[model samples]
Target: MSIYLCISGIVFSVYLIANLWAMSSNRLNQPGYVLTDLDGLVGVRHNSLSRLFSGFTTLVAKQHIRRIQVSSECLTLFTDADDCVNIWLSDRYLPINANYAKVLFPQAEFVDSPFLP
Candidate 1:
């Protein structure tokens, strides 16, 4: 039982370390959409695990965005079809200027969304 607990602790620690490293790296800004053009229907590409895991299924097949919506806690991008990408403001992948998202997406409806703890 002690050995099992030790192994579990090690695994958990590794997971936390990896997540922190990824977050501190700022990998999301590598390549993809710009905040200014997002409202104009420009597509943003992000491959970060933090942002990707937020709503991966909706965005996996979407390459182009037709609409952008910003709430207090999340940013949702819609494809031309029915797909969408959702990014939580609390995620490290999110740009520091995330507050500007609301200004860029003025028509976006405000809603309650999930955030990282």
Candidate 2:
């Protein structure tokens, strides 16, 4: 496994420890993740995959590595019902993001996403 996977695992594990174990405060007040701001999400298409991957890694680390009151993780950074998503990528690896997207949709239309948001 890569260091990124290790880092993510550590983060969720710690969250389980503090929350499920009741060793810490309410998770809503001390979220393990954060929502990246609109600025961070805007024009996210880096010139290279390595750059995009590295940037995402940094963002995740910055968000989950800390224990804060306001987690961007609680925020929904994007609602692209009116946008055209042109992901010009050669490979795919969104880690836990697929779960988020799948949970957000339930057999939704693909060709014409009238409710993409």
Candidate 3:
């Protein structure tokens, strides 16, 4: 009986330690879609029109912007059918302000807008 009790105590301790470690190291996967901790969208009429983005889907904002900046460079650029909105990227991979982050693949542009799609 003592032996059984000792073995159970050790197993419980190991399990608790493993769970704590996982939490500390963030090994636990979060649900996809969490975006940011910034203020939500605001409108003139004070209408609720935005959802909080969070979780694993935050990868959407994880762009590897390197070397150049679009605001500094006026280089004209285009998007693919998927409209991932890549960097303007001149011949030398220079950055351009294509503003692909805000624009969905074909959200506003495809909706009879003179500026896009």
Which one is best on TM-score?
1
Q: Rate the local accuracy (lDDT) of all candidates.
A: 0.48, 0.29, 0.27
Regions of candidate 2 where Cα sits further than 4 Å from its true position: 1-36, 39-43, 46-83, 94-117
In candidate 2, the residue pairs with backbone N, CA or C atoms under 3 Å apart (3 or more residues apart, or in different chains) clash, namely 34-72, 34-73, 35-72, 35-73
Model 1 global lDDT (CA atoms, 0 to 1): 0.48
- Give per-residue CA lDDT, model 2, range 36-98, as digits (tens): 333323222211232323353222222122111111222122233332223221112222322
- Residue 1, model 2: lDDT of 69
User: Taking the tens digit of each residue's C-alpha lDDT, what string does model 1 give over 1-94?
Assistant: 9999999999999878765664455544322332324333433333335443534322232234445555554567665575766654434434
Q: Number of clashes in model 2?
A: 4
Please give the lDDT score for candidate 2.
0.29
Q: Give lDDT tens digits, candidate 3, residues 45-114.
A: 0001111112212122222211211332122212333333222222221211133322322232322223
Report the lDDT of model 3 for residue 106: 24
Weakest 10 consecutive residues, lDDT, candidate 1? 54-63
RMSD per model, one decimal: 6.9, 15.3, 17.5
Question: In model 1, what lDDT does residue 25 have?
Answer: 58
